[model samples]
Target: MDRLEAMAMLVSSVEEGSLSAAARKLNIPVATLTRNVNDLEALVGTRLLIRTTRKLALTDVGAEYVATAKRILEEVDELERRAAGEFTTPRGELVVASPVQVARLRVLPVVNQFLALYPEIRIRLVQSDRIIDLVDVHADVAIRVGRLRDSSLVATRVGALRVVTVASPTLLDKYGWPETPEDLRELPCVVFDSPSLSPWRYRSQDTGQIYTIADVPRLLVSSPDAAVDAAIDGIGVTFILEHDVHEAVIAGKLKYILQDFEIEPIPVHVVYLSRAAMPAKLRRFIDYAVPKLRELLAEFGRIPSA
Candidate 1:
């Protein structure tokens, strides 16, 4: 058996979750994928995967091997790029991942401009709110907001985002504006359910104290887009990144409130896995993208009354 080919098949199988899925991604027959994995297990003298009727599970050893195989593949790709003098040309596929709402509202337009400038470079945008494993997902770069706990990855702060309390004009007319954080409990509120079960958090600008709303939400949503829509329809007040709701607020679909007690600005970052030798394509893309993203944020921040 070709050891490298078997290793590739094994990694693909693990990532794709089944031999059939790996075969589909690799453009090979399922039988061939299965055979390669079996050969790989035999050579290693251990079963790498625990096969079940429904899905494949990796053994502890299999998990370790997968990590190693991924690094090996990345190194091999880097070597090939170096051999082809990719460092100078800035031409290759660049895969980026970001939250869907942010990508649609902020990054997509900038991406279009980037593409127009560098026609030779190909781009793939992956929209997901969940934190993706950069290496395993084959993502060249990621745009993230809020506090980053992953110390393993290299991060560059591109800009900051402020959490704004927003509601519709109709809701404000009926319920009246909240004068303080304590007043929020008396009004209906929309809450995002993903990060935490709690309601909006804020700091007292006068007393320099932090507080959280423990009141039950009139509506709970799992996505920011849903929260924004609910607020636009006057369902309830919600908290979202100012950049995400700026346009709606400007158009009178939504209105901003509680400016004095606004949540602290969260840093937006562009993150990537560290390597001794970085690909020119990835480097060029970041260099071109970061400044533009910062400029976009600055422009948004200057929008009066948003």
Candidate 2:
């Protein structure tokens, strides 16, 4: 039997909780995976897994073996990478997660350029508005906007984005622009349904005072794209990151109001799980990404109306 292959299959089966799922991930037949695992058990002279019709459970011995196997595999991988000069060279798959709008408008373009420069490195991007559990999902890095909760993760500030109130030109023409935050109470407000929308917090940089607009509608949506579409259709005034609507504003499709009131600039960060030592892939990515992100933010800052 291929002991290393069997060990890999065993680990995958344990993590996936089923032979079928392991097969799918490993790109092997279910029967082949089962046979390899059985061979591994026989070679070790012990039953590693307790199998039932409905479920698979690991024996106490299996749990111990799995931990050792994982460590061995990781070490072997590290050795191979070093042998290949990857310890000094950044090459391999880098999985990243970020919100949809940020991915589309900012990250994708930069990633495209990065890929062009480093053809050996592969990038997998997962875009969603919901927060993803990095460890559970096996994401190498994440780009997050706004305030972050306390965690063991390491975060580097990339830039900041302002939340802008925007509406279609026609809608603004009809409803008229509000001079003060209180005037927004009468106008149709497009509310983003995310947790960030709660209390509608704003602060004045000049006065150092905080204000929040309350009693807003609960027209919650999952994505900024949907919210922008709603605004473009004249549904209501919606709040979004200025980068998201900069093009629309320039095109005269969207207009901003309440510019004098200081909405706090939400900090953007590139976050990764803390490790004893940063791997080459992570370090190289940060080195490459930081400067590009700074340039992008500077470009956004120079936008005429942003």
Candidate 3:
């Protein structure tokens, strides 16, 4: 049996969750994949997987073996890429993950310009508000906001985003300005139902105490853009990242309020897995894109009104 080929099949099957799915991805027959995995188990002297109608579950031994196999496969891939001059030449597909709004407003423009500059590099931009696992998705890099807790990943902070409270000028005229955090009780609020920013948090400038406002929302929406629109239509006040309301604020559709109560700026970052032999494509994109993003955030992403 070709040990490396069998290892590759086993890893693919484990990741893809089924032999048939892995076979399809590897472009081989399902029977062929099964044979390779069975042969591998026979050679290793243990059953590696618990095959089921719904899915494949790894045995304790199988899990350990698969982890080692992945590392070996990655080392081999790196060696092959180095041999093929990919380390010297910046040419390959690069997968980048980012938040939806950041990608739409900031990262997309940089990606467009990067593609024109580096003709050989291709990028797959994955936009999501939820956190994406780099290893699970095989992403080359990601744009991240807020604090990062993953010790395994490396991060380079580009800039910061402020969380600001805003309302339509019309809404403010009716409700009047919120002079203190306690004053929000009198006004209607549009809540963007994200766990990170929910309950409407604020920081005191004088006392330095953090406050949470838990009053019932006038409008509840899953998306930040929807909440911003609702706020602009004079529905209610919404607290969101400056990136979401920057344009609307400039156009006079929205106005910043409770400026003293806003929290510290949330840091934005370019992140990736720690690699010993980082690919040239990944390196080039980071080098090219980081400065452009920093400039964008510095000029536009900062708290504009104050």
Candidate 4:
């Protein structure tokens, strides 16, 4: 048995939580994965995994071995990357993770320019609304919005975004304008349910106090774009990032009503794993992307009327 390959499979199985899941991730058959893992256990003269129908658990020894395996594998990967001159040259695959709408409007343009400048480098952009662990997904960098939790990851602040409440003129005409956040009780609202930003909270500029709107949403949607669409169709008022509705607001399709009560601007950042020796490709991309993104987000963060 190839010990290195088996070790990798074992680690993958532990990380992925199942032999079948690891098999799918590695693009290998489940039987092959199982046999290799079994072989690894035999070679070690001990059982590493406690298997069940629902999940896989590691033995105490297995847990310790897996930890050692991870370190060894990481060292191997680093050595290979060094041998490939990734440390010296800006030539390698760079994985960047970003939100869906931001990827479409903000990040893609910068990526296009970066690719043109560095032909030896290839980029894989993973766009999703869900927040993913960078190390778990093997992403080189991630564009994150809002306040960041305390962690070991390095972050560079790019810009800020206002979360504004907006409604179409037709809807406001029917319901009348809300003079305060409390007035939303009788008005309809389109809520974009998301983990990143909350649309229901508002901050007062004068008092610096946060308040929650108790309005029951007429339309509750998952996607910000869909919520914006619902608001445009006069379904109800919706809260969204200012940039997402800039065009519609300018076109008179949507209007910002409660600017004074808008929540504090959400912070944006470019984040990556903290490392002692960073690869040239990642370093180059951060240098090239940060400034451009800062400029773009600044523009996006601007409220058209306010």
Each model's backbone clash number = 0, 1, 0, 0
Q: Which ten residues in a row have the lowest lDDT in candidate 2?
A: 297-306
In model 1, the Cα lDDT at residue 172 comes to 88
TM-scores vs. true structure, each candidate: 0.92, 0.77, 0.87, 0.89
Q: Could you tell me the lDDT of residue 147 within candidate 2?
A: 87
> Per-residue lDDT tens digits of candidate 4, residues 1-306?
888899999999998999999999999999999999999999999999999999999999999999889878888988899899999999989999998888898999999999999999999999988886787677899999877884888999998877888999998889998988888888888888877665488887778899777656888888889999999999998888887888899999999988778777889899999988999999999999999999998775445543
Which candidate has the top score in TM-score?
1
Candidate 2: stretches off by over 4 Å? 1-19, 34-76, 195-199, 204-207, 214-218, 302-306
Give the candidate order by descending lDDT: 3, 4, 1, 2
lDDT of 4 at 201: 88
TM-score of 4: 0.89
Model 4 clashing residue pairs (backbone): none
Q: Candidate 2 lDDT, tens digit per residue, 1-306?
A: 888889999999988989999999999999999999999999989999998877789999999998899878766876787788766777888888988788888788878887888878899999877777786566789988778894887898989887888878887788787777777787776677665555576666468698888755635666777788888888887788888788788888888777777577888888998866556776888788878887787666534433
What is the lDDT of every predicted structure here? Answer: 0.83, 0.80, 0.90, 0.88
- Candidate 3 vs. true structure, TM-score: 0.87
Candidate ranking (TM-score, best to worst): 1, 4, 3, 2
Model 4's C-alpha root-mean-square deviation from the true structure amounts to 2.5
